[model samples]
Target chain A: MTVSSDTSMIHAVGLRKSFGSKSGETVEAVCGIDVDVRRGESFGFLGPNGAGKSSTMRMIAAVSPISGGSLRILGMDPATQGPQIRARIGVCPQEDTLDTELNVRDNLYIYGRYFGLPRAEVRSRTDELLEFVQLTEKAKAKVEDLSGGMKRRLTIARSLINKPDLLLLDEPTTGLDPQARHVVWDRLFRLKQQGVTLVLTTHYMDEAEQLCDRLVVMDKGVIAAEGSPLELIRAYSTREVVELRFGIGEHEEIAPKVEDLAERVEVLPDRLLLYSSDGEETLAKVHERGLDPIASLVRRSTLEDVFLRLTGRTLVD
Target chain B: MSSTADDGSGALPGTLIRATWVTDYWLTVYKRTWKGTVISSFVTPLLYIVAMGVLLGGFIKGDPAKLEGATSYLSFVAPGMVAAQAMTTVFGEVTYPVMGMIKWHRTYFGMIATPLGIPEVILAHLGFVLFRVATVCAVFLLVMTPFGVFESLGGVVIAFFAQLLIGMAFAVPIYAFTVGLKDESAFALVFRLGMIPMFLFSGAFFPVSNLDAPMEAFAKVTPLWHGVDLTRMLTVGNIDGPMVLVHVVYLSALVVLGWFWAVRRLTRRLTD
Candidate 1:
């Protein structure tokens, strides 16, 4: 709620991270990358596995030291003013590190005390967060008893205890069921409506599309592409995407003949994707080829289209 | 990012102190896990004393008793009990507990994230461990006293202080090892190789001279040997100034070395 000026919430330039292996080989987790997260915007890092999303998230959270870069959080250097910057930031890490020893309410209470909150204020806020997360009845229960979705929700509630100016969530709903995922997304959307700055990393293109105001797709520790989801879809893809599937090996024989029907054509292992501004026209042209595919579906261009256009595969790989 | 103006709160004098306060908050974790700490520090030592000193005391002769310069076996064994108790209590309190915080629980990471530096974490953790060791040692001393082990009031006090010193000495190396512990094997090695020999050969049950020549020499060089000697001297009122000097010097050296290593390791781990 306390918006301290409209300055950029987080900024980093030429950030890099590398870990030395036992064989004296150094694995570059994050190559030189620049990023800026302005106030009141949902930012996202969308990438496949081992694309350095976690390494970047760790550096931004001030939990891991940068190898070679200048980084700032709330306009303060994380290298020097990590404590000050962290004081106002909430980070929900990729892996849940919730204290299992304490009850759900105590978990919030103890974490709030870590931020030096008055004990009375912490108690009041814990009550509020439990209600917000719809966990009022389960506040006295141990963390180990909670389901995966419930634990994730508790973690999100714990992060909001200090009412942090900036919130960082790494894959916020990676392993949740669809209903649970929607519930998390709904809560995050509400936080965003209140103008909280959110930075999230995810492999789900659908998640990025749903949450991010702006996103950067990364590959092999480098940014492959960056833009708003809609902007990316428009810039990198057509207005519609047609997926054509044939009976097993039939795709190979018919795929090469359907290339001229769309603006761009991609022959995948299981299917063929035809990109065109008009889906009906492309499908009519495909019908004119005198070949029948097992199945075909035309959908509007999405962030997944952008991902496929840039990385030559889906984001979930 | 604002590249020029500085807030300047980073240099606050109370920052480290506040961080220690935050790190101290983790002691609440013990409210749920006090059983582990109790069993290792107090229960294990009590069992050792009861099984070795009480149960076996009737079977062994108490004359010149192989432990030279001792009037009775019980007197010698009693002082040795204090030293042994101190080493185990201190070692158990600091080693696995500190390592659990660092690697297993990752509680230090949570602490460091909240403006608490690694040194504050170290200091707070050590302070808590030492306080716990002192309390457990006191309780052990009192418990043994009812069994007629504490001959003089001064003996009880000497045994307490001796345990504190030896426990601290063992804690120093354990703290140093904790920073480098990549896995549980390292601590297993500490218990098996480092502490087991010190327990058996460092004049805990019998006098060091009773051991074969090389074994006695090895025991003489150990911190626990000096601790036992100092405690025994104080208990029997045959105090030697040089022996006290050796205990102080050895323990002081270990403390300095361990603290320096821990600080260096933590700074590197935090900053790097």
Candidate 2:
């Protein structure tokens, strides 16, 4: 019932969502996922496709209902206080729903008015937001005329019209050039610096490593792993990962021979992974055992390694 | 960051009616496109009077008075034009505009995310549709005065009310269909296969009794017939007590059904 709290900006305990007309055939998009996104901290939901990241974000954004269990945003129940929570939160959905009939400036101006902002204030903020998104030159252009990157930026700018305390972004930069992705990252970084709490969903491991203070890797309608990106790597993966490739049939023959050289050995169809404290030392051990790998590479372990180790598959898959 | 008193209860009754949001947004849209819509609403009635009353009526050699129960063919057709205009306004204002807000523009998605509820959105649309129907009827009534179609001030007022009831009655259901539509083809089908036949069969241009039994039965069940009957009763002072009750019930049922369907659709869209 309090407006301000030092607790999580969003909290969910046993949240669940399922869809389908039939009983047993229902697809549980989110299955009893518990989360606590603290105020002023950037939280990330890291997962691959069909992992229920967007569904959870939708629940927190108050657009999708909590099928069961407790959920709160800005210290209010979404079912009862949806409007108030939504008023205090800004959401940039996975898909851009910009009004194509209106030009860029009107898109911002009209959405601002929906929050009851004054016409003069909407005008001023329109100018400010266009400048923020670097779309001032294209202010009068219809939304249909803008590129994908430009539209995504405008959506982010539009979400900030009310200067929301909690911001929800679903796949903020899914399909964009590197330059456009960096622009979005920079804006999000600026928002973080200004003490805005952000909860974002993305399958991109690098995006999570770059922006998140703490993250949860979701899989199969639940949180498969949760920690800081670095913490998760330390817990599930070693300091360095060595990839050894060989001819298709040789990988299986070499798998057992190199099993004891590293802390963990994973055999793949065309390659093998050796998780070791020292990648160079592990490679030397592989050579000492007379295993002539077709190719070998040593690299620092990443969140992708942890994700792959935890879920038994690649993150981007 | 600005902290104010926490009214966390958020229990202000009627505070969330929030029709003003739609009205505010629509007023902006309407202001930008008012003249075009106004001209469009009047064109149909004007054309109907010219083509049906003037040109078609001219070709008929029989006594127009004996056939129409009016001294002038223009007077008889003028009331029908009001009925036609009201029906057209309902279909136009209620159908695509509301659908576009929900599906295409996704404006309602942004709206329901605010303090506004689904019912408030529906009511605001109904309010806008009724307001438009009333305005168009007023304009049509003004155009009819010179032709001596206004029997009395009461008749003019009755005609306006009839237009509003008829508009809302059709609007509620069409608004439902608009929300449920998955594609644009269904909208074209409504206009082509549905609305055209309703207009022709519902006594908007002529009396329903002039048609055969099956067509008459279809007209009696439709909201357009009740609306046309109400408009005719007002314009000509030909009120039969039982007939008035039938029109009122038919329109009321349609309004209720439309409202029910619309709310259910909103639940499915917003909650799911």
Candidate 3:
């Protein structure tokens, strides 16, 4: 195994990926991009659907080949040392690829065995992971019998069987309930506290704000912005946001009336978002104009506003 | 327990024992489901021998010359049944299970995501199939012994090895084909169009010399034909030097060619 002198957990330069269509056209999935994930940091890729987040994660996992440029994981080149790179990283793919034929504990055991771990060592680790995922009671249950959240947790636990240095999670909490998502976030937070370098991709702004120490916002196969949640908000968004609902289709008409009250007015289908330094003062000014129609609330600026300001579109939409 | 102790800095390339972990997985599954597999592997073959060799041999009144110097039809068809059983079991094991692991259950995808590469996955699975063939052939040989078909135990052992060779000769290519398939519909056609015809015309039930000229020539070139011939020779203690070498070389060549093709196809399909 060849190790590089670079200290970054993951390092890439001008990475690109393209797929060939039947008519000889090429679709560039991941356009040229540069990324560096430092050790012991939870780095995130925040993007919408079909934004090439999963493709980039797959390349980092060493399962998919890099079309051009360079990628190094755990200081090893993925092109020549893929298996060695894969040996050191744990990947939780967007889809749960757990073996349905095996029980919960066996899933971890078999994956550990694939990494050539000793039987006794795998046994102990399986028990520990099952408990860590809060599935010790369901350890013997078949994988298909678990709920969606439980299965996702098991996939995360399975990825940890080899105790990899870097963990790649693709939409880890997607399709999960609020409580289940929180549970997953709590486990991930603990892993981060233990100094596991985490790399994840998600479209949920809250998930990104809660878990990522640093992140890059991607759109149309390119990095649009990159920073910590607070830094990105401070750089691109106002101090507070006022959400005002005038009527069903009256947001367009009310946007101009309140356009002068805030730094910027964004008209939406059902609401008008007024970006201002003091949202309460902006709301008082709106009420003084006799533009009251339905509802109004002032909240602190978040990553969602930052994403909208960068991409000119909402995160989920 | 806060931090992971394994940095994986000392990871080495995959070895033979690590590859066998795939075989170990199959063995563990078999531990739970072996009872279900016993009938097809043992009982069905035993019934075929009883019906075709014992009861039918008793009904046929033929001269030893016409029966290829055999004293009875029971001894004549026993080795043929052994060879055919190996082919059927090995083919059955590789077909749906291989496809399910690729398309349906996606277990092979799960395996490749780990440190194991595509070659190790293919080798380990084929190795497990070989283990199954050996076990099934051993049981078939024991069942044949009680029926008074074998001339000696040493000869029975030799015939067993021949059956394994024939099974692998067919298995590796079929495995390569299964990896390229998108669905299981083609498996039915393989059984009906390919395996059935070969099973019937490969001189398993009668001598190829009794067949018409072109048909007999076609049968002579089949892997199962060589397998049946070698197995029958070993069963009756009638070993021939030149023909044994010819059969061994032909089957071994198929195994080598099929193995190379399987590795190439599987690596392409799994890796990208």
Candidate 4:
């Protein structure tokens, strides 16, 4: 990605982050990498834990120092102008660092006050944000009294106190239940519609596919593949994957017989996956080979398939 | 930021104003929890004044030198109580709250996520501790006025400032130590080993002259002793300029040193 000051929200070249472990060894969290996020775009970092997504997010948020390489956020160098950069960007951290000392409303108000927002502005913005996150009824409630999903909403509202241009959410709905996740996703979707630039990291393929306009699949502190969810699935995996589960311990034995039946065959412990553009043709070929399968199913390729194809590992360990 | 930031252009430039904002956060939070602290800062110390200074002073009849240049034991012990209260209040504030900010709740991480730096967070939290000490000392002075413990109004005024310094002497350095802490376990040892001994033997209730050489020397090196000595001298109108200078310089240096140390520790802990 070329560095452009005007349209670029985030531009990085060979960015790296290294941490000193307790055992006195240098642990490279993020190896040298390049990333660029344009204005109003939703970018995702799809990787498992220890994949350096959080380190990259921290460096981009201007909270963590860049260990090496040059990076810019909103066209400002984070090393030299961290405060000025932070003043403009909203950060929803992985853990909800909500002010347990204050009520839901005061949490938003005090955060705005930290930005030197005027009293009237903070008050009105606090009200507006509470309503936006659907926490107006719980405005006077203590932070500890709120549910897990409510705390996350309050954190998102607090981050938006400054009306930031770029919003950095680190696994926004990570610990949330399915219903809570949908609530957060809906709120985030609205934020995207309002044209707030979002940078998020998640191992959830559905989350990345639903939220991201473009994404990078990271593995072992480096980006393995970078593209849209559809593009990644198209590039790295077949159009569809056919799952055929045989009798007990028949997958490995049946894999060799079905090797020429489809474009590719993956033998797992309980099932054999045949990858091809046409899953029905592959299944028909399997039957023509006199392969009797107890169960069979077909599904369109997803980002998980792309990840499994690229890294040969599951997204969640 | 564009429309409402006109008033944010404060008298000073940008650096100190942000610190005040962080301090403002403490003040706002303190508003909710201030009621719980009254007994410790005000009621308990005042109770000690009634129990030890007034009740015990009536029994020391034969000794004039034992009063330590004061007309009564109440007057002698009153200023000492003020300074000791500062140390207790500030030490209490800095220990668990500092640990809570750093480790338990990670409130400091929340602050640093904004434009507020680590230095501002440390300074503002310490400022809030000093504010608590000032209020506790001031209220102590106000209520103790009825007892006729203060020898001079001017002396009480100076002692008030001395208590602030003493409070910070404990607060800033302890803050430096606690801001990097991982848990509240070390605080039990600090209270048992550091706070309890200093409160008792820092010439607060009794004169250090009555203490042995090693014990008195230990008391002299503590910030609480300097606070008690300086505050006592000012409250009794027995001003010792050189000794007061020693106390002032010592506490002030500790305050600055502690502040810088806390900043360094917080910087290391919060940043990469």
Docking class of 4: acceptable
TM-score of each: 0.89, 0.91, 0.90, 0.94
DockQ of model 4, rounded to 2 decimals: 0.45
lDDT for A276 (candidate 2):
97
Clashing pairs in 2: none
Clash totals in order: 0, 0, 0, 0
Report lDDT (Cα) of residue A265, candidate 1: 88
RMSD of every candidate to native, in Å, equals: 3.7, 3.0, 3.3, 2.8
The 0-to-1 C-alpha lDDT of every candidate, in the order given, reads 0.78, 0.81, 0.85, 0.85
Q: Which tens-of-lDDT digit does each residue in A36-132 have in candidate 1?
A: 8998899999988889999898788876789997888887777787766766788776667787767899888877776766678889999999999
What value does the lDDT take at residue B51 in candidate 3?
95
The RMSD (Cα, Å) of candidate 3 is: 3.3
Distance (Å) between predicted and true CA of B36, model 3?
0.9
Chain A TM-score compared with the true chain A, each model in order: 0.96, 0.94, 0.97, 0.94
Question: Model 3, range A115-198, lDDT digits (tens) per residue?
Answer: 777789989999999999999999999999999999999999989988888999999999999999999999999999988999
Interface RMSD list for the candidates: 5.9, 3.3, 4.5, 4.0
Best by DockQ: 4
